[model samples]
Target: MAKKNKIGEYLYCITTKKDAPKEFNIKGMEDSDIRVMFYRDLAAIVSKAPLKEYEPTEENVEKHKTVALHILKDHTVLPVALGMVFKKMGILTSTMGRVYFVLKKSLNLIDNKIELGVKVILPKNFEESNNGKSIEELREECKTEFAKKLDGIAVESKEGKLFSDRLALNMSFLVDRNNIDKFSDILGKLDDKYNDLKVQYTGPWPPYNFVDVRIMSRGK
Candidate 1:
């Protein structure tokens, strides 16, 4: 008989400490599952099950959010995207070793810091008007005008770069942990001004997008 394909489990990258909690009763889709492993300054919270049980169904994907929310309570975690895996323990260990260094550096830069995601969504009518005007005219007149406005807000808010889009702007700010409330207040003011645009913000999360890992060797 052909070997059954094992479902690769998802892993969470977490910070290490002497007092790090050993056991976490993370609520899973079907049942309560305990996180199983911890490495240097990183934890791989995983549970194994038949492929069918954790298929990439819409329901299963939503369940993963529960896992993330529960884990975030105690540890700063870089959530590994869904469907991450390795063929064996050796590969997993090697991968973790490389990831550990990158995460360590990011943690140093972001110690006691949080990542806040800010996305400004523009109205559908604004997006549809792109073809009506000459590209250069639109670029100079509308895009640049809006970008300058966003930049002023970014400067005043003292947040990160102001990313420009067709009608929206997306920005990720690395703010001190203590200043999150103040940051939210600033965002509230921006929301008041741009009442037509939708301003969505999320998190006080670990700086996942800021960490970049380049693994040179694949140790067998």
Candidate 2:
């Protein structure tokens, strides 16, 4: 067993049995600082890094992505953000106990599902007629237009509203695993339809945006 530190916290990448990786390497941090734990067919790839190490620097953030990507390759990982902490094991246990049902339900819902992140990047430079519009105005216009279109698709497709249309308008979609191909096709069609904007899509990722674990205490 490893000795526990009073001020440090373990960050975890949670995953299900079908998608969990056998092992993973934690880069850009001490080997002794990281550890992996498994529980009842679920696993948590964890590391004991200090709070200061969790800053938004490119290197540190990349380390988080590195860990998440490695696990996500095989398992349906719940990628927790950097800086998650627990003061004691009891707190960790308590939080898990309180939320395990919800977590499990979410896990099952997302088991074979993969998250697809779609972003439409407007042209950096356009004619003055297009460029002079305020970002807020463009954002609202995009939200309204995209929401109407996507809501109709969602209804026809019979997928429950995972989130409000406002959130989904400029957001990610937790697509069914089997629908990835069809989803890609739709993305391509949309891209061609709005060729004026640059559309970028990423993942098949663990549903990082959806799962939330409430640790009872705050960090310093």
Candidate 3:
């Protein structure tokens, strides 16, 4: 069993740009310093963390999101999921170096782009709350509507990775930096069409839905 007090590097996100804030004031688990590890052009935002069996407790989950939000304002980041820990800095470097080509490919795909999220939610009691519209039919209609109207503004649009039965639609758009204003305006209007569906839209998020770097302490 891993020791409860073991200390390790907990990764948060990655960026292709070499320039970063000289002084990183954001933090992760235990309020430890959030710092960047650079391997050539690839840099990962990581923080020191206690490496016990980690769980997604409310506090830890909040800290993880706080770090992502802090980075999103300035940088287009590729977020690592919560609960990642590296035994040492060297493992991170080796893992990144080994997969440098793939890493770069994903970065280029989202360059100068950020992810905007849209969640289509329905009332728990669909019979009374769904306005008698077929939930699956509405989801399909929303997708078709966006493709017809907003395809020009979005670099790409795809379904969100997170899934649940109650969710009508989970999606994110890869929108160019300059087109954010136009994109958001259209999205807000699009969401309004379904009055019966309670929608939540948030954005300018790090491309967490798009990135999947699963390197652990032992370098995969």
Best-fitting candidate, scored by TM-score: 3
Which runs of model 3 end up more than 4 angstroms from their true locations? 1-3, 124-132, 161-166, 217-220
**Candidate 2's residue-wise lDDT over 24-142, tens digit each?**
55553434345555556665666655544356677666776777777766566666766666655455555666666766776776676667776666655443224465545555665
The lDDT ranking, best first, is: 3, 2, 1
Backbone clash total, candidate 2: 1
Lowest summed lDDT window (length 10), candidate 3: 125-134
Cα lDDT tens digits, model 1, 43-129, are 665654333334677877666655655655555555555444444545666677766777666656656565677776665546433
Candidates arranged by TM-score, highest first: 3, 2, 1
What C-alpha lDDT do the candidate models reach, one value each?
A: 0.55, 0.59, 0.76
Worst 10 residues of 1 by lDDT: 151-160
* TM-score (all chains, Cα) for each model: 0.64, 0.70, 0.83
Checking candidate 3 for backbone clashes, the offending pairs are none
The lDDT, on a scale of 0 to 1, for candidate 2 is 0.59
Worst 10 residues of 2 by lDDT: 153-162
Off by over 4 Å in 2: 1-9, 17-19, 26-34, 51-53, 87-94, 127-169, 217-220
Model 1, 162: alpha-carbon shift in Å? 13
